[model samples]
Target: MSQSPEKKPRLDDPCINLNLEMNRKAHYTDSFENPSLIVRRGFPINITTTAPIDGVKLVYIAGTKHPQRDSQRLFGWKLETKSSETNNYQLTPPSNCAVGRWTIKFTIDAKEVEMQATILFNPFCKDDQVYMECPEEQEEYILSDTGLVFIANSWRIKPQGCGWVFGQFESRVLECCLALLERSPLTPTSKSSATLVSRSMTALVNAQDDNGVIEGDWSGDYSGGTDPSEWTGSVDILLQYLETEKPVKYGQCWVFSGVLVTVLRALGIPCRSVTNIRSAHDTENNLVIDIFHDRHGNRLESDDSVWNFHLWNEMWTKRPDLPDGCDGWQALDATPQEMSDGCFQAGPASLNAIKSGAVYLPYDARFIFAEVNADRVYWREDSDGNYRIKKIDKKHVGRMVVTKAIGCNDVDDITDQYKHKEGSEEERYQTRLAVTFGTEPDIYENVEDEDEVKMKFHCEEDYIIIGQPIEYTVKLILKDMERATALFNATASVYGYNGKFICNVQSHKCELLLPEQKVFKGRIESSEYESVVRSGSIIKISVMYDLKEATDMGFLEEEIPLRAPPPKVEILSQEPYIVGVPIQLKFSFKNRFSSALTGGYFRLDAPGFSSRDRLEIDQKLLEPGIECSYRVEYKPRKKGKINLVVSFNSDQHKGLHTYKHINVQNSKSDDF
Candidate 1:
């Protein structure tokens, strides 16, 4: 508050700033109660001496959370240096402090300087507070020790502090941790944010590797590209899948736990990690009860959601004798999944193996979970001072929850909406459901049981048109196709380049007399890319269809499904299809109001597409509002279901696709 910009330097040029950056302050704060908060505001202490002081010393005194018997005196200590500045001096608290009135005394060239601060024994209030007011709750941030996360509070995502892993990247994790630690108090009794930040930074520097990487034991590889923005770091899913499929697999992901443990241990910060069972991601990643093993030679396996592979650390006071409220340890993690992107607190139930010592094992009974979770990390902090978590990370899905979220794959490029199906965890958090099974986000005119409504749409699964006219067919299917003559509507366009006209259809549908496929004989003209662009641009030929809720005048057990066999746009061309080369993509399609247009978005991910081995386009805007076909040059990795991402600004809506290859299966390959 002293002039927002800079702190006024009292006294002149004979000063210096010392101490460590991050990760360095923790070890120095162990013996002190509630370390003072470190701030970015630099404090310069200059004492001009007639004759340079031989051994100058500067002292800072602060109080602990409570004035206990051991720390009889306040956290008071003097840092001695040959020069006055102490050159950014750092300190580790004395193993023992005589608990009493605390004060600081400094001497420069024998010119004495003194300051004092007090520690209070507020028995009624246990949580840390600065000034006279305390925060309702502390923001959770993940910290790593021994390559694992010590999850204290929830990260901003997944609201309400649910554990989630965003990505497995060091830079992202460091940025998140630093942002939070910079807010903690430095001294136990002192409300000094600067103190905490400075010390934490120092601690970080000491633990970093020569390559500047901060991980202790975790691998350096990270999955997913940044721009495409698909980050899945959930541990439970992986463990669950391994457990179910390869029940004899060894080595649980302890490297993650080790990272968290290492960070806390580096600074004498007491912490523990809690772990539990996890649900599966999809049919692809099933939670199988396999033989889970660790580097330490420990192994276990069971078909349990409560004991799945997981790791979260807990923070505690450095001393075993310290009381409950004397600045307890905090938890954090690099695994967004374990932390549920910061869903729970750093208390007892994070993960156990990640703790400094074997702490979580002994404190296992004190775990709890959420009860009525609308969207919250359920944990119990009862009046009895006991803590527990239940329903450990539930992906309890029901009904038919469809999401507008698409998968980040080739077919659904970056432009499509993500289509989430029923029974998937993403069905709730990612996709768009027409009608929810559990809770309804909105009630859009709940029609009577016998009422009928019509939905229509136009779609196309496109390929190149060589030289001949490509005939395509579109259909609308129903459970009782024989009962209702499902109304169908569609339009087709045969336009040349820029503006050269061809033909257009405003509306059309299926009929027993009319042809199901359209013929475009001599519709395409051979020309260069530039010549094609020179002619007017091509237009889309669309077909629309709809069906009303079947009404046999009485009982129909289930609602009939209307299917629009996504229209095909194949280009009959003279140029042959390359086995492994990208050709200019020139295709078009139409849109209708179809239920399958779930999120109006999709992704097109072709493996052998880019020469640079990079994918950068997002293609999910193919919905009705944005009509027509798209033209772009793209290469295919292999033959399969060409997905098209159809969402706009829907970061979570990159479409999911199942690529189909001739005589081949798409296994979950390790991208890293």
Candidate 2:
């Protein structure tokens, strides 16, 4: 008997289906866990070639976070191949591939799809744990005695790269050796632990597997003992330098040393393949020096070979760590060591590296670069196993497995490479910037205070680069100049994001600088005058400047701190107990002095005051007279009155409550 039709299921079930955010992430897969030294998978990558070639190395390329535009740390290729066929997933790198943390990238064409994996031997970070924004300006660079990092360029700033690309360009790499002196010149930080860095250097030298070698030749290698100092000469020796300090742009060209650096990075080592392609004929080296202004020549205007010949990078291996605390690989490898010490101990021929006779020519070949002769060094140990870097010769040097693609000369194909992108010329007309005013929403900010206005204007990121020195003449107007003058001595800053040419204006009505290069002398100023009063400022003002990179949103931003913790509670009344009697509860409260509270929340919880059937329920806010009242009515099912408690929470206030004890009574009993 189908008992009168069973109730139909409700179509609307309240189940929340999650919509997760999928991203293109880079990671290394671990094969082992417990002992944690195994790697299992690596994302396959291929060059942007159509009919992929044979023996061409392709490595993971990560973007940089440097505000200067080029956000690249891991520059150059990641893998090397000499095979004469199509490169694919079938092509596996050596098992002992270089170790350490790296963001693995996936590429099929110009666009990239990314993923990530953590190898115990070289574990990848689990989260955006790489916090801490890097310095936005050269001035922000700090030489701290922190635990691991020594001299850091971008300190204290943590750039959050929200999308798939990591924010490392805005992150700091610790220089352990330099950090040694930070702890009062005695206690060293992780980066400064000379012993640990030296130990890793030993590991790197020892980890030199014969299979890792990719044979190649150095053009300047000698049969017997050779002198790198004699070949490259001391960088200190400036024979012909137009500029004594700033670097002279070298044009497109590739030497054998540049090839070596690229090969190393492919094998999972951090290396640079610099192209010091000279544009002018120096007649000294019988070759042209790579000059920026010139197509392909060296200048006798300033006979400087160090600045002319090649660009170099500081590379780190899985085993042999660098003396400095250089993590993974970096393009921002600039350090006081290399900059001050002058050159690499290991000459190109003596580096014991795999060589590749290759040349990569970018349009701006002057800026393009790779490794150099002095970049490599060796670990020397005596009877006691103490290690020091001993110079090595060419024979022991490793090889760069030159891919057959080396035979191809596709270097001159013109491609539009611009700062904001091509055909986007129009996009350049409009500039984007992050204008900072208050650290947080200064809803209570006193615009009247010149210091506050000065702080707001000064707080702008790279203000001068965008507007500085009152180019053509705009002004940062103070809304009520007379009124603002009464409270604030306002100042402003114009930056170029690099902090260079960062000008600070101590005046409220200073001239504005041109915001862009097109009109270096174009007039600019504070978009609007700041009002004397923040509450009534009809003017939502901004300082106009030329922005290097366009911002999606206009400047004049601020963040608000968490609202002050709110007020609290007090208890009032409850119902008397009985089976069928109506229950009542009351509470007492007054506005606590903190953030303004519009309303309050009351929580009514009962464990055993159950009514088989639904009981009547009522809750309401009472009007304010002398004492405000909260009233509620419910029927009691059992003998006793339940303990009713209330809590209040709001955006402006929190942590408030009180309790009302309801004593149930029998309606008919004489025990009133």
Candidate 3:
């Protein structure tokens, strides 16, 4: 028998390979090494085959149910040969194409080849609905993964930055993100629209109505799950959810916002976390937060609440589903605060609509409008079992709106972007317009203030740090100098970050004769709130004044947030770090409190430099005024700019997180 020669591969062979490496770079997704080609729409993608073909067509199919040809979720495009190359061709997805993972099929010479790729909303393309003209904004909102979340009480303190690692490009994150879309209640056709997908995600991020990612728990009980404050990033939470196929145990507003940002950025949607200080939760949707108080000036339970600070996500997208000029940043909240359209989701509400008081627009615009512009009405119960409005604060809700600045770690005040200047004529006009569209259009129709006494609560210091006495002043201005006698009462209570009352710290009652202008100074000893401050609670002081001569009452309250001194972080290793080399870091903090500190621990997390599991160091007790130091060693795995985040938690304090940027160089050197 003679040995037969092996047949060479032919141009029309069944085995065909498509080259997408060049397309990845052009699409600006070369940084991510995904199994499928990740691309943004409206950009040309060059495809080269192993052999020349007679004919070619690309088919894209999204979702598994009721797929129709040329539909929004299912479409195909024919490619033209590029220049004179036989095996090279070019294809461009329309700017309005569906955004998600798509199954692509190439039919060449009557042979079908199957592959997968993910298409994202393109902000760089001028014709894309989600187009953002500013290049700086596109880089910050769409590409930046790590960011700062502002957490503070705007009433008495300035906003502070908390480092968050989104880790959108981490291994398996894109797969997990696509899985979330599959688990949503959206129909296959609805999933094709970016606005609908964002709306569905608000419900999918929390485990309230659906078995989604994070379960919200604000009861201060972490017996079975991790605490929300201890979470360093979204990578662990997402991976845990994918692995167990169950909702993670506990999370808060910031956690929900953080995870949603990761999912959106991974899917190529531009998103950022926003913090609204003194955010209102309007249950009745009348744009009024009604707080009830007893005759003794003690706060009673109510359906409405004003959180110390609330965090939500803002996604940049076009709003063809809405009116014109509503195509900028859209607010989307996933904290599961309230239900919308029979589910626990909120927004895709246009920020422009919110600012312009177009609360009648689609997709829960009124609810979001109230969140940033509601009026706080205090109702006091009288002897006849009737409630009377004691005071109304117009500037209480939405005191400050902020987010992370572009290309920096600074806080960007976006208050004007959401609403006009407070107390301005334009602001009042917009408020009136929004109120007219509310469910209770006549809420402020007959309400009037007839009382003559006015009360104002002021904090003596710019900010109150933990382990220090809190000092404040209450000034009462009596118009007409009527020489009135009044009963003054001050009560301080510890309130959680979720605006839930924990326990009363102290109370003081006094009888005073009001002068033309009277000022009362008060102090809350550090010992009174030391035990409760460890739970990350703020001190809410309620001041009540009853005027005997005028038979009227006045109430004033202020929330004081105690700032924690951050621990100093130092990189002991020299600069010019190379890949695969170990680096040393040192963290030190002093116990400034009068009492000893116990149950102290430090958590270190670096997305690319460290493992999926965070590094934790536990410590023993440290006496007062004692300085504690810790040293950690981390080795770089890749070369780039990496962020090293360190957080300290103890029985005396919690959530003291900070980050440092480390630039790692490549180990290999090339000669010029």
Best by TM-score: 3
Writing each residue's lDDT as its tens digit, candidate 2 over 483-523 gives: 22211122333221111122443234232222221111122
**TM-scores for every candidate against the unseen true structure:** 0.26, 0.18, 0.91
Q: Which ten residues in a row have the lowest lDDT in candidate 3?
A: 4-13
| Per-residue lDDT of 482 in model 3 | 67
Clashes of 3: 0
lDDT of 2 at 629: 38
TM-score of 3: 0.91
Candidate 2 local Cα displacement, residue 145, angstroms: 37
Among these predictions, the greatest lDDT belongs to 3
Clashes of each: 230, 97, 0
- What candidate 2 gets wrong by more than 4 Å, as runs, is 1-221, 225-272, 279-303, 306-329, 332-672
A best-first ranking of the candidates according to their TM-score comes to 3, 1, 2
Candidate models: Cα lDDT each: 0.26, 0.22, 0.77
